[model samples]
Every structure is written in C-alpha cells, then in structure tokens.
Target chain A: MAVVTSRRGRRTAAPYAFLAPAVLLFSLFILLPVGYTAYLSLRKVQVKGLGLGRGARSEVFAGLENYQRAIADSQLWSGALRVLLYGLLLLPIMLGLALLFALLLDRPRVGLRRFSRISIFMPYAVPAVIASMLWGFLYLPAMSPLNYVLDKLGLPEPNLLSPGSVLFSIVNIAVWGGVGFNMIILYTSLRAISPEIYESARIDGCSELQIALRIKIPLLIPAIVMTTVFSLIVTVQVFSEPLTVRSLTTSVTSTWTPLMKVYRDAFAADDLYSAAATSILLAAITLVLSFGFLRFVQRRAFGEDR
Target chain B: MTSTPARRPRPAFLPTAILLIGAVYCLLPVAWVVAASTKAGSTLFTSFTFAPSGSFFDNMGDLSDYGGGIYWRWMINTALYAGLGAALSAGLSGLSGYTLAKYRFTGRSVIFNVLLAGVLVPGIVLAIPQYLMLAKVGLTNTYWSVLLPSIVSPYGIYLARIYAAAAVPDTVVEAARVDGASEFRIFRTVALPMMVPGMITVFLVQFVAIWNNFLLPFIMLADDKKFPVTLGLYTLLNRGATEPALYSLVITGALLSMIPLVAVFLALQRYWRVDLLSGAVKA
Candidate 1:
C-alpha cells in the first residue's frame, strides 16, 4: 500500500487541506447555528408608533429579558417536569429490558435468539414520526385490534390517550422504539467479554442468575452508562413522536415537550426571541444533565480505586 | 472441564417465552400496518384489524393518485436527501476524521473537541436559528437547506476517526510519505481503499439519521415538491385525521416507508457496530 518511501517531501499544508471541508461545514452548520441561537436569545423586537409603517418594529438587544421570561415560563417548567417524569419512566425499563434481553440472548440455551434480536431491533429503523403514527392508530379505540380483542373477550377498554395516561403512552412508544438499540449495545459488549470469565464463575459453583448478578451486570456498568447518557440526550430532544401523535389526538398540546415548545414559540406563536431563549436554556440544562451523569459515573468508576 | 455441577438445568421455555412476548409487542404495530393497509377504505375500520382485504393494490393506487402521485415524489425526495446528504457527510467525515487521526497539527484537539461538543447540542433546537439564517441568504425552502446542515455529522466524524485510526496504520502512511507520494495521493489512493469499510459504516449511519430527520426538513422546506417522506407522511396523516378515507392511505404510506429502511437494516445487520453507541469507537 505504501509506494512513496521518502518522508522529507511531505507538505505541512496537507492535514489542514484535508480538514477544510469538515471545518467549513462544521462552522457553517453546527457552530454558526449555535452562535446564532445564542445571539437571538439576547435580543427582542421593539414596536413603536402604532407599529404599522416601515421600521415600525426594530430589532434590539434586550440583555437577558428573554432569558428572564424563559426562566419564569410555566409551560416550560411543566414541560421540563413532564420530560423528567417521562425520562424516569423510560430510562429504567428501557435499559432494564435491554439488559435482560441481552443477557437472555447471551445464555447458552436461549431459543429463537436471532429472530427475537432482529425483531426487537427492527423498530430502530422505523423513524420516530412513523413509529408514533403506527402506534397512534393502534392506540385509537375504534382502530385498535387490541381493543377489538378485549371487547370480544368481554374486557374493559382503557383509554391510553387520556390526559392522565398520555405521557405514559408517549413513554411506551419511546421504549418500544429505543429498546432494540440499547439491547444491541449491551449485547455487543456482553459478547466481547471473555467466556473464560464466565467459565471461572461456573467453576466456582455460580448459577446463571448468580453469575449474571455478580459478574455480568457489574462488568456492564460502562456500557450501561453510555446507553443511559445517550438515552438522556435523545429523550430530551423528543419531538417527532408527540408531535405526530398530537395530530391524531387533541390531548397533546403544542408545548408537549420542551422542543415542542421551542417549535410552537418560534413558528406557531411567532415569538422567535422567546423561542431562542427557551431553546438556549433547554440546551444548557441538557448539557448540565449529561455532563453531570458523566461526572457521577466517572467519580464512582475512578475514585473508588484510589 | 466441569469444576462443579452447581448451575441449574437450563430452562429454555421461560427465556424463549419472554423474548417471544417482547417480539410480539415490538411487531404488533407493524403487523397492524400491514393488515390495515390491505383493507379497503369502506372496510378499514369495519373489518378486523389483522384481517386482510383485497384493497392493498387499490389503496396504493389512491395514494399514487392523491396530489398527482405526490407520495412517490416524496419518496424520491427522501432518497435524494438521505442518499446525497449521507454521501457528502461520509466524504467530509472521512477526510476530517483521517486528518484528525493521522496528523499532528496545531489546535487539532481543540477543533476536534469543538466538533465533538456539536453532538451534545440538541440539533432540533438549532432548526429555528438555521431556518432564520438560511432565510437571510434566501436559501430556506430549498433542497440545500435540508441537505447542507445534515452533512456536518459530529458523530460520524467521531466514528470515522476511530475507523481511520484502526484501519489505516501509521506505518503505511509514513512509508507512503517517505516514498514521496503527495499527501493527497496517499490519502486518495493508498488510504482511501482501506477506509472504504469505515466510510460505508458512516454512510449507513448517516443514511438512517438523514432518513429519520423530520425537524430539519420540516423547518427548511415550504414546498411539497421538496418534502421528504417523513414530512410528507406527516402532512398526509394530518389531513387523514379529518378525512378518514385517507387513513388507509396514511397507513399504507407508513408501511411503505418502512420497507426501504427495514431492507437496509436487515441486509447490513453485520456492519452496524453498535459499539458506537457504547462510546467504544476507539476500535
């Protein structure tokens, strides 16, 4: 593969040249949007003199007024708290099920392992909007086969779309869509662990459950943390599911999630400045939460050995 | 090899039963979509949810005729966005990742970290600002608006860097440099073939991502002509709420959308290094 044998002729401009496309794209798309969002967060439009003619509303720096409004916004807080609950509901069961499935698949005698793994992971391919739409139809009483079966069996129908239960409805879709990816991550990591470790546990008279409890789960901490952090990031940005499901049912508000609020404020309500502030604030909270999780894991993982 | 006979006899039924239950739960909606799409508009809700009718072809015909076959146009638009976007993203990620991995340059770590931080920023939050910025340049409502933002994939770059470090050995690069091959030639020729598998991995990852992207295209495009399938189906589903007749079409469209993606997922099952999810991309 190596034809050239002389290193002296290498140019200093090479690496930068290679990186120019990424640098340009990163600056234009990623960095610029962030900076623009931050810049918009601090400014508001001033309307004066009946606000009718040219220059009636002038854009001007508000110096954190939008931020103050965002901080006090009740809808934003409810949305945050709602997501907090949703995240709590989602992360544990999703990860726990994922861990369970991964462990089950790793076991020696698990049947239909390949089929179950593929079927479980298949939803990862279904986009969130599509997944929600599919589930939305199923949640509709008239359209739902589950409801049909229940009625045939003389069972009571529960409203999954009620205001009280709608959040859990959303969480179910998330778990359904998310479990497979997490399962695969856990399964992959589990596969990479040396079988010799399991052999030793077996030789020490450890049962399968005992070995799993004492060895596999403990060794899976790093992978589990990774999945948790990723889940945290994805859940906070939840948009498509609720947004799509809202159309089928009137129960979902425009500000269902914080991202939904950002969308509603920006487009629906025509309040770009407030939306900017809200998004920036949401972004900050997300950063803090993710970084805090990382730090918590790091402290426990590293500090204990000392 | 047995040191002890302490482990209980393997009970296959319990594990198999649990997994099958999970599988059924996972596949239920999918089965419904397939079953629902087969019913005629009149018979859709009137029939069993899983019962098949002879209207599958008829529903496809209606979806095709609706908006003068705009559904197919959405499918085409989706292909363009996901395919072209992922291709460009893979190219940029490959080049940038290769540079970051192989070269010792000033400010490299800083630049890489800055890009890495891009992954943490909720991309959906940036959609509005991106929309406004593109509006300034009169670029929103265009294909470039959706395609452009997607090309800068921080995660792809991170994955690509890992792939490059593993696939392209430094010794080969040094030998090529010593042989007086131009750096671009070494990269384009010697190193690129080695990076193809990695590039394809990035391509597949970015492909699914861009395929699933709803917010970017939702905010960017105002024209139905430019809508991806996700947004297209969204618009259809919104209309379907009032027009129950359109439910069959929406259901049909939803089923169709999964076909391409599921095919890809199944065919490339082996290539998906979920280790990317585990933050162990250093391979």
Candidate 2:
C-alpha cells in the first residue's frame, strides 16, 4: 500500500515537475512584469521638500490619477490615432496582397511556384529594423532609384519622406516585410484543404477564379481571421519600423505611435509611472481588440458557435 | 498545337505574372542592397542606385576596421543570444508541451490558458516593467535580462503542445511505462526524439525571433559590447545621420547581418512549417 501510494503520488507530481520550469519562467517574466506594471501604474512619486535628498520623494497611491492623465494626454490620443490610420492603410493592402499571392501560388499549374514562394517568404528572415532601414535608403530621394528614374524621365520627384506621405512609405515597408509571412500562413492553410472539393467545383464548370472566390476564400475565413487578429495585435504595437525609419526622416515623431509614446515616456522622459499607465491601457486595448475580434468572427463564421 | 482536346488549357500566364511580381517586389530591396553595399560613401549618392561599384571589398574592409571590430562582436552576441535562447526555449516548450499534452492534472487548464493569454500581451507593456524589475535587482544591463525573458514563449508552447499531441502516441508511452521506465527517462529517450521535428520548428521560430528582436535588448543592454546586430546597426544608422561616410559601413553591416538568418531559413526550409503554426496538418 505504501509503495502503491508513493508511485501514484510520484506520477501525479511528475507533470508539475516537468512543467515547473515553464511555469516559473512565465511567472517571472510575463506575469511578474504585468503585475509590476499594474502596481506601478497606480503609484506616483510624491516629491517632499524640493525632492533633493533620499526619502524626499516617496511612492504613494495615486488613485487613478495616472490613468486619468494618460487618458487626457493629447499625445497619447494622437499616437493612438496615428496607429489607427497605420492599421487602416496597412491591413487591407497587406492582407490583400498576401491573399492574392497565396491564391496565385495555390493555383494549378502555377509557374515558378518554388521561386515565388521562397522569394516572398525570404523577408520573414530579415528583421523589421533592417527591412525598414533598407527601405529607408530606397525612399531617400538623393539615392532612391524611383527618384532617379523620375528625374531622368524629366518628371517631378515626389518626396517619400515628406510628412504627408511618410506614413504611406512606412506602410510600404510593412507590407513588404509582412505580406510574405501572412501569405505563407494562408497558403499553408489552403493546402490543408482536400483536393476533392476543388475537383467537384471544377467539374461543375466553375472557372479557377470562381473556385477561388467562391470556395477557397469562404473556407479560408478561419485562417484569415486568425492572421487578421495576429496582424492586428502586431500593428497595435508598431514600434521598430517607424522607430528605425525615424532615423532617415522627420515625419515619424518621437511619439508617432502609442507604443512609441510609452517608450518615450518610460525611457526618454523618465516618467515610469505614466508610461506604466499608458502601457497598461495599451495592453487592455490589445486584449479587448483581439478577443473581441476573435469572438465576433467566431460568431459570424460558426453561426453563434453552437 | 498538339494539345489534347479533353484537357482545357489553364491560363497560367496571369498567375505566373502576379507571383513573379511579388517575387520581384520582395527581392528588389535585397538586390538594391547587394548593389548599394558595393558603392563608396563619396559616390553612393552620386552613382545610379542599381549600378555596382568596385569598392565592395573596400567597404567590407572599412566595416571590419570600424570601431575596433565591434561589428563582429555584435554578430557573435546575436548568434549566442539566438542560439542559446532558442535552444533553452525549445527545451522548455518541449517539456511543458509534452506534460500538458500527455497528462491531465490539477490546474492544467488554468495554466495553459494563462500562458496562451501571454501571447496577446504586447512586448512593450512587459518590457517596461521587466526593465523596472530588473533595475531594482541590479540586473537590467546584464545578458540574463534579455535571455531570461526570451525563454518563455507562449506561442512556442502552444505549438509544441499541438505537436506533442499529434506526434507522440499514448501506446508508446504506455509501453514504456509498463517497462518500469521513469517519466523523465521515457521523455528523454523516446518522446523527445519523436518531437524533434516540432522542436526544430520551435527552435527556428525562436531563433529568428531572438535574432531579429531589438526592443528587449534595446531596453535591457546599454553596453555597446552587449548590443545585438540589430541594435548595433541601429546605432550605426543613427550615427550615419551625422556622418554620411558611415552609411557604407551600415549598409554592409545590414547585408552581413542578414546572411546567417537567410541561410538558416533556407537550410531548414522543409522543417520551417507554417502548417504547424496555425494548428493545421496537411491532408
């Protein structure tokens, strides 16, 4: 009985032991940071007696002051609006190109399928920083081939880094970096679909475009939703691309996006309290958007998930 | 002219053209860099963009000779961070995934759900608190500050769990259990081998992620010696804003930094499965 009890106990405890490392790491990194952020967001340093000596400034509970300030901060609102505009421009075009390329590659008798797939997916290997840098140079009018060609043709050279169009330039870099990965995911999901479905659709005298539009896309709704949510989550936290491109241009401000604002607050302005509050808000927005979007799509796609 | 009547001619032209266009669009910048990296700083702006110059070796020499060979240090640091971080992360994911997939225990669902939720939390949100916490502990500038946080990947665990469930059969584990083998022993000797393909996928994903990651190291390490290639290159680019001469070195560094990752991706192209990423199995 002792041996049997010990054996069963060991078996039960084995899983926890196996999972201990991940649980510990996750707690220390993800849970701890989030909890710390929450704690910091609610606390403010009260400067006592000119704030010159130790203990002169002490952390005190601010009772939603930081949150209120963050909400009222026009810079944060502008940053959020900028990210929204970025997503608005980035999503449809990126996903559209991804879907188009995916469908084209999935088509029967497609030429250079391997080359196209590998070439398109190659950018996934390049870091966003590098991708932006490369595109940054290409957008520089002095060295840009686009401007060079335009100038040679006696046409006006449009400034890509101008404040009015820098957003579009940033959008182009993201599309270049992103379309490939999204295309791969969508394409992989497409390949999971059995060929017999397509065969029947073909036998019914439907053209390839009809099959693609009517059958392939409808079945791809789940995968599309997944990619869209992933992209949305990523877009909400747009940091490195604009940050990197900011080196070459003046349009992308120090607070061009919400996360950038958080970064500036935390690092540049040394306002950890406000940065913590803004980041918490950003995290909340991300969770709400992703979950809300997922639930919304799930309901529509599966007819109320019954 | 000799095509069979029963087979309808597929208009492969448009699809081919469209895919080729994508390929060209994707490859264009890379091609430009390959050409641009060859030009000298004096002529980089003066010359046509695509025109290659003979200063390629000179530019590479300058990149190497810049800042007492610090560029190579960044390269080595990137390799170490990515290689070690990914390996550790893959191992943890494998173990946790196997445990979650093979066994049901107390708080299992809750644990899995919490970790899955970690996937949606933006890095910047966590990055700030992580920095603060590490700062409190005097570890903010250490290598551990970056490597420690990178090892716990919720998406990796999710993928590993799916892979473990699909790949490892209950009977094999049961058979090993019937032989009086310990759980860890069986995992090490039997289950781990079966999970190799999935683990490789996890490793490559984590590898690319840590390699390409800038924000964590950017926030963590202030030491130039500890900077990864991404941060190092960014600093170089920032300096290039003032000294245009450094642009050649920055361009060369960017090109050089990409080679390892592109090589790794291509070599492991077969195992780099997106099907597993989205929880789909090819039919």
Candidate 3:
C-alpha cells in the first residue's frame, strides 16, 4: 500500500513532464513571436537626420504610430476589401460545391462516385504554389485550351489573370484546391448518419431531392459551418497562390493583399514596425472572425460550439 | 421489395455527368501540366497546347543538370523538413495531448484552450513575427528556422488530445501502473500502441501541411540551396517569365513535386478513415 501510493505520487509529476516539450516549443515559437511582434509594433527606427550612419537611425519607442499608419494606409484598406470580396466569392461556391458533391456522393448507386471523389480530392494533394503554377500556365493565352477552343469557336477570350478578374482567378484556384477536402469532411459526416433516418423519411413519401434538402443538407449544417470557418481562415491568409501567379502577370501588385502589404513593409520597405502592427491587427481580425463566428454559430444553437 | 414508379429510378446518369464535370475541372490543369511538360522549349508555344510531345526526358535532364542538381537538393530538403518536422510535431502533440487527456492537472483546460487558440492565427500573421524572432537568434535562412517553427502545431495537439481521450483508455494506464511499469513506459508500451492510428493521422496532416506551406519557407530562407521544392519552383517560375527556357524546367519540376505528395496521399488515405481531427467536435 505504501509503495503503490508513493508510485501514484510520483506519477503526478509525469504529466507536466510529458507536456514540457510542447510547452517549450509553443512558447519559443508561437507565444514569444507574438509577444515580440507586439513589442516591435510599439517601436520604430528614429532617423536623426539623413539616416545614413549607424547612429543616425536609432530604434526608439513609437506608441501607436505604426498602428495609426497601418490603419490609415490605403493599400491595407484595399487589400482587406479585396480579401473580403475574395472570401465572399470563395466561401459560398467552394462550400456550395463541396456540399453538393458530398450529397451526391452519399446517394446510393451514384455512378463513378469513387472516381469523382478521388479526382476531386486529388487537387488537395497538389500544393497551392504548384496548383497556381499549373493553372497559371493554363491561363496563358498561348497555352490555354480555353482560348484555343474560343479561337476555334470565334468567341471572346477572357484574360483570367487581369487586374480586374484576378480576384476571381485566385478564387478559382482556392476553390479547386479547397472544395475536395471540405467535400470529404462533409461526405464523411454524411456517411456516419444512420440510414434508418433516411428509410423512415422515405417511407413518408419524400422524394430523393426532398430527402437531400430536408435530411442531408440540414443534418450536415455543423460540418458545413466548420468547413466554412476553416475556409474563411485560409482565404484570409491567401498568400501562396497570389504570390506564385504574380510572376506570371503584372496585374497583381506587391501589396495586392493585407498579408502581402505586411510582407512588403517588413522586407522590401524595411519597415518592421508597420509590418508588426499590421500583423497583429490581422491576427486580431482573424481571432475576432473565428471567435465571432463561433459565438454566432453558438447563438444559432450549434450543437458543438462549446 | 417495394418498388414505385413514382420514384423515378434515381437517374445515375445525371449525378455521374455532374460529377464527371467536376472531375474534369479539377484534372484539366494537371492534364495541361503533363502535356506542357513534354514540349521542348522552342516548340512549347509553337505547338498546340494539348498536343503530346517527346521532350519529357529532355526537360528532366535539364532540371537535373541545372545549378548542379539543386532541384534534387530541394527535393531532399523538402523531405527532411516535412518528414522530420511532422514526426516531431506528432510526437510532441501526442505526448502533450495524451497528458492533457488522461491526466488531471492544474490549468489543463487553460493550456488546451491556449493551444487551440493558436490554430486560429493565420499563417501570414505568424510568418513575419517568426521570421523576425529567428533572425534575432541568427537562425534565419537556416533549415532550423523553418523546421523549428513548424515543429509546434496546435492543430496536431488538439487532434492528439482528442485521439488520446477517445482511443487511449484510462483503465489501460491504471493496469500498467498496477504491473509496476513506469508512467513513461506505460505511455510508450501501452497507450501509444493503441494511439498509433491517431499518431499517424496527426503525422500525415502535419506532413502535408508543412510540405504544402510556402509562406513560412519563403520568408525564412533567402538562399536558394535551402529552399524547399515549392519555393525553388516559385523562383524558377519567376525566372521563367524573363527566360522561356526555364519554363520547361519549371513545368517538369512542378510535375515531379506532385508525384511524392500524391503517392503519399494514395498510400496513407486509408488511415484517414477515423478522421480524429474533426471527429473530436462532432457530437
């Protein structure tokens, strides 16, 4: 009894010991960086005069100056607005198609379901950089089969990577890469639903369409919302696709998105203060959107928000 | 069997057709890459876009010969980063998650919540700060910069905690303790084997995530030699714009990068059956 109790006492320390590595890493990487960014955001390089010599430009505290510039910056506003519009386009269609394909895949006896499912999910395997590169070449007029077909048919060829249409073009790449994973998540949930529910509903004279609308779609709400929140997060952090395609076309400016502006400020313009401020603000926005959506979802009586 | 004419035989044709359309849309770009990769540099634009050619081997040769096989180095670098990073991330997540799951500790929920909050912070927001922090330590532009930052995945931990709770039973730990085995030994010998499926799932998710990720590596490393395949190919693509010859190499490099990831996807997909990631939340 004495030995057992002593061993039990010793085991109590084990949990904290097990958690040490993760805690250390999280602190070193996530926590410390976030804190450093907050610190950096509060400081600026004070130029003494011409900013030529080592002593000329000194690092000094500049409370909220960086934040003020970030807020007032037109590029940041346009980038945020563009991302908002991009998210609007991406979330609906991507989730909609994902939901539709998932529901269709769930239908019994749907032909080529396996083939369709794998093909759709295949893009999820392709990295965003490579996916955009592949699609980038396809968007080129000389290589685009769309243009080739349009040329043969004498229809107007659309410039997909143009400044005006580039948002949708980027959205297309996102949707292509995103829809499959979301579809699989939904489809998995759909598969978990017992067929007895469908059987009982079918006995009540519900058609297949009605059954999907009333049963599958309604039942998959939690899954849909989960995927949407995820997509929203990813869409906001949209970097790889736009950055890759920027090389293919001049339409995308260096500051095409808020994140891009942050990158440009930090690296190109040598303004780490502004970049840090923008980064924190962006993180705050993301946290708000995430938590806000969760709250909204909870308010709407979501079963799993807590 | 109760059959009804009222229920028009669920037309398999329409569903199949709609699905086929989506599949085509998804595969068209990949198909274009495959065809485009076969063309020699001069004939790349001259020939029809979809027309098949015989220069795939030639382009592969060029890619291998370029920069003293730096393309191959990127491939090795990618495997190192993703493989080592994911393995460590999964291990740490597993240990932490299992601790959070099976143990009653002070600030357990607080720690879990704090870690979960990390998932919501977008990669862009974190990338610059991480870059700056690493630069301070003079670790920037080094492999450790990318690998170290990626080793901590909040999502992996969340999934691990869920898996440990769902799969690794408390009774097993107790049983192991009664046998006079150490706590660490029990975790290694008893709880971990049961959590194998979950660990693999976590590892695969992190692997793909790190592999597919561009911004972190792009910001961290300026040296092309240290670049992952994605960044290397991006720079190659950038150069392709001014120099058309590099385009063929870019096309071939893009195709080569897809193979390993797609192979891993095909091989490990069966393990995703449990989906402990999202399964945690569903009631």
Candidate 4:
C-alpha cells in the first residue's frame, strides 16, 4: 500500500513541477496586473495647496467616486454608444459574409476557391495599425481612385474621413481585416462534417442550397457563437484603428473609444487615478457584456456546449 | 438530411461576384498604397491617383534618409520583439502543455481555469498596471518591458494543451519511462518531436499577435528609436497631417512593413491548422 501510494504521488507531482513555470508567469504578468488594476481603481490622488512639491501629493481611498464620475462622463458614455453602433454595423455583415464564403468554398463547383480564400485571409496577416494606415491613405481625397472617378463623372466626392463617415470607414477596415480568419475557422469546421451526411441529402433529391440552409447552417451554430463572442470582445477594445485614424484626421477626438479615453487620461493628461478608475469601469462593462452575451446565446441556442 | 425538389443548376455568378467584391474591397487599400508610394512629394495629391510614377526608388531613399534611418531601426525593433517573444512563448507553452496533457496532476483543472480566465481580461486594463509595476522595478521604456509581458500568453498555452492532448499519447511516455529515461529526457526526445506541428502553430499565432500588437509598445516605450513600425508609422502619420510631403514616406513605409508578413503567411500557411472550436466542443 505504501509503495502504491508513493508511486501515485510521484505521477501527480511531475505534472505540477512542469506546470510551475507557466503558473508563475501567468500569476506575475496576468493575474497580478488585473488585481493591481482593481486595487488602483478605488484610490484617488489628493493634492494640497498649489500642488507644488512631492509631499504635497498623496494617495487617498475614494470608494466609488471614480466610478460615479466615469459613469457620468458624457464623452465616455458616448464613446461606448459609438462602439455599440460600430459593433452593430460590423458583426452581422462580417459574420454573414464569412459564413457565405465558407459555405461557397465547401461547395464542389466553385472555381478559384483557393485563390479567394488566401486573398481574403491575407488581410488578417496585416496589423491593425498598418491596415488603418493603408485604408487611411485610400480615404484621402487627393490620393483616392474613387474620388478621381467621381471627378471624372461630374459627381460630388464623398469624404470618408469626415465626421459623418468616419465610423463606417473604421468599420470597413475592421471587417476587411477580420472576415477571412472567421471564414477559415468556419470552413474548417464545415470540412470536418462527414461527406456522407451531404451525400445522403443529394441522394434524397435535395438541392445544394436546400442542403446548406438546413444542414450546414444548423451545424455551424457553435462556430458562429464562438466567433461572435470573440468579435464582441475585440470590438469593445477598439483602440488601434481609431488611434491610427486620429493621426490622419481631426474628426477623431482624444477620447474616441473607452480604452482610448483611458489611455489619454492616464498618459496624456497625467491623471493616473481617474484613468485607472475608468479602465476598471471599462473592464467591468466588457466582462458583463461578453459573459452576458454568452449566457443568453447558450440559453437560447448553443445549449450543448455549456 | 432533408429532401427537396430538384432545381436547375444556378450559374456560378452570385457567389463569385460577392467574393470578388470582398476581395477587391480588401485589395483596394493595398493597391492604393503601392501606387501612391511611387509618386514624388506633392505629386502624391497633384497627379492621378492610380497613375504610375518614376519616384519609387527615390522615395525609398528619402524614407531611409529621414532621421538617420530611424525607420529601419523601427523595423528591426519590431522583428526583435515579435521574433524573440514568440519563440520563448512557444517553448514555455510546449513544456507546460505536454505536462498537463500526459501527467495526471492534482490542481490541473484549477490552473487551466485560471489561465482561461486570463484570456477574458482585456489587454488595456493589463497594460496600465503592468507599466506601473515595471516602472517600479526601473525597467520601463526598455526591451524587457515589452518582451517580458508578452511571454506569458494564455491563448497560446490553451492551444498547446489542446494540441498535446490530441497528438501525444501516455503509452509512449510510459515506454520511455520504463527505459530508464528521466522525465525531462522523455519530454525532450520523445514528446518534443510529436509536439512540433502544434508548437509551430502556436509560434505563428504568437508571432502575428506580438508583431501586430500596438498598445503594449505604445505604453511601454517613449523613445522614437525603440518604436515598432506600427507606432513609427503612427507618428509619421501624425506629422504627415502637418507636412503633406511626409505622405509619400508614410505610404512607402506602409508598403515596406507589409512585405515580411506576406512572406511569412505564404511560407507558413501549411502548418496553420487551427481547431479552436473542436477544443471548445470537447471541453
């Protein structure tokens, strides 16, 4: 009995020893940072007369003041609202196109499938900053072929970077960079379905479109759910595109997105306490929104995964 | 499978048309950058948008000459950060994942759950606190500031675990153990080879994530010499708004930044079999 127990202990111990490095690194880099941010969010900086010297400033505990302020800030709320609109525009169009392309690629008769897949997935390799830079140049009136064509056709050239059109421009960039990767993900899952499933449908005299609508779409619910959640998380943290676009036009303000506001407050304005608080708020909203979406979807449709 | 009435074959027009439209949308910006990079200063706005010009080499010379070739420094810095960071991340993930998959351990589920939770934390919230902690250690604005934080990727570890579970078998480990090999030896000689394909996938994913990352470097470093191409082009664009002549350099630099990634994607596509959904399904 002693020998057997010792051997069992040894077997269990090896895995933990190997996992120690990953556990330690995750604790230091990820876990600790999250805890530290939450802690910092509850504090405030107190400045004494004229704020002249080092001793004049001190940290004080200000429970929920920062949260209230963040909640009340019109700019931050509007930024969140703007992102909601952007997500509404982006999620359905991008995911719809991805599913369509994936289904098309799965069909046997489609020509240039490989070329289209690679070309579409090519943008995922490009960084968001570079993507925005490239798209930004194309948006420039003097540098755009669309504007040149409009001039030739005697039509008014619409400004893509203007206040009214900047959101759509940003959404277009996000969709272009994202759609292909999602398509590949869905396509891989689609390929994994046994061919016999589709063959039986064909033997029963079902058209390809009918087979896809009934079988393929129902089978792709899990992939769609996963992609939707991931896209939601990414869209909430929409910082790089707007930040890059800010460099191109004055229409983008210092506080264009919630994360960008946090950056500006912390780095540009030197308001670390408020920035920390705002970031905590943003993080909370993201957690609630993502998990909420997951719960809702799981309850309604993706019941098997949970 | 449901049965339906037979129908005539539709022309391969609608799907082809929609896909071509998307491809053109994706390609338009890239095409514009390539065409715009050829024009000389001020000709960027003055000439026809897509017309070819003769100043491509001259613009490259001008970008190289700008600020003592700081653009090249940015490029090298990006390569260092992405290359070294991804390599270290892949190594760590491989070891940890193999252990988790093959060995039956106490607290294994707890550790994995914690790591998965790390995935849900948005990166910005982590960046601010990480900067503060690094600053306390007097390591801010240094290479380690970016490299150290990037080494521990939750998603990489998660993928590695999935790969190891699917690819490696416990029977092989027992065979090696019976042959008097140490645990590390078995891992190195027996397990590592089996895990290569998975490690390569992790490496590519981490490489792209780190290379394309902007927020970490944005907050970690302030010096222009330490800037990655993403941040460098950002500053260039900011200044371009003031000096229209800088547009050509920005366009040229954007085109140049894309070459390495395109080469990597084309070369590495074979190893990029991602089964993230399958893992989720199994769990």
lDDT of 3 by residue, A1-306 (tens): 122223467776787789888989898888878888889999998888788977998899999999999999999999999999999999999999998898888876577778899999899888899999998888888778888889889999999888888888899999999999898889888888889999988889997789999888888887777788888888888888899999999999999998888899999998889999998999888888788655543344323324
State each candidate's clash count. 6, 0, 0, 0
Off by over 4 Å in 1: A1-10, A292-306, B1-11, B279-283
Interface C-alpha root-mean-square deviation, candidates in order: 5.5, 4.1, 4.4, 4.4
Which of the two, 2 or 3, has more TM-score? Answer: 2
Model 4 root mean square deviation, Cα atoms: 3.8
Residues A1-306 of candidate 4 have per-residue lDDT tens digits of: 123212544555667778888889898898898899888889988989998988998999989888888889998999999999999999999999899989988876555666788888889889999999888878877777889899999999999999999999999999999998899889988987888999989999998899889999999887887788888889999999999988888889989889899999988898877788888887787788678554553354324323
Give the per-residue lDDT digits (tens) of candidate 2, residues A141-202: 99999999999999999999999999899999999999999999999989989989999888
Q: Number of the top candidate by lDDT?
A: 2
Which structure among the candidates has the greatest DockQ?
2
lDDT of 2 at B136: 91
- Residues B130-182 of candidate 3: C-alpha lDDT, one tens digit per residue: 88778888999999999998999998997887788778777878888888998
Error of 4 at A13 (Å): 3.3
DockQ of each: 0.53, 0.60, 0.54, 0.49
List candidate 4 stretches off by more than 4 Å: A1-10, A292-306, B1-11, B276-283
TM-score of chain B of 3: 0.93
Docking outcome class, model 1: medium
lDDT of 4 at A178: 93
Which ranges of candidate 2 are over 4 A from the true structure? A1-7, A292-306, B1-11
lDDT of each: 0.85, 0.89, 0.86, 0.84
Error (Å) of candidate 3 at residue A208 is 1.7
Give the top-scoring candidate (TM-score): 2
Cα error, residue A84 of model 3, in Å, equals 0.9
What does the lDDT read for residue B119 in candidate 2? 85
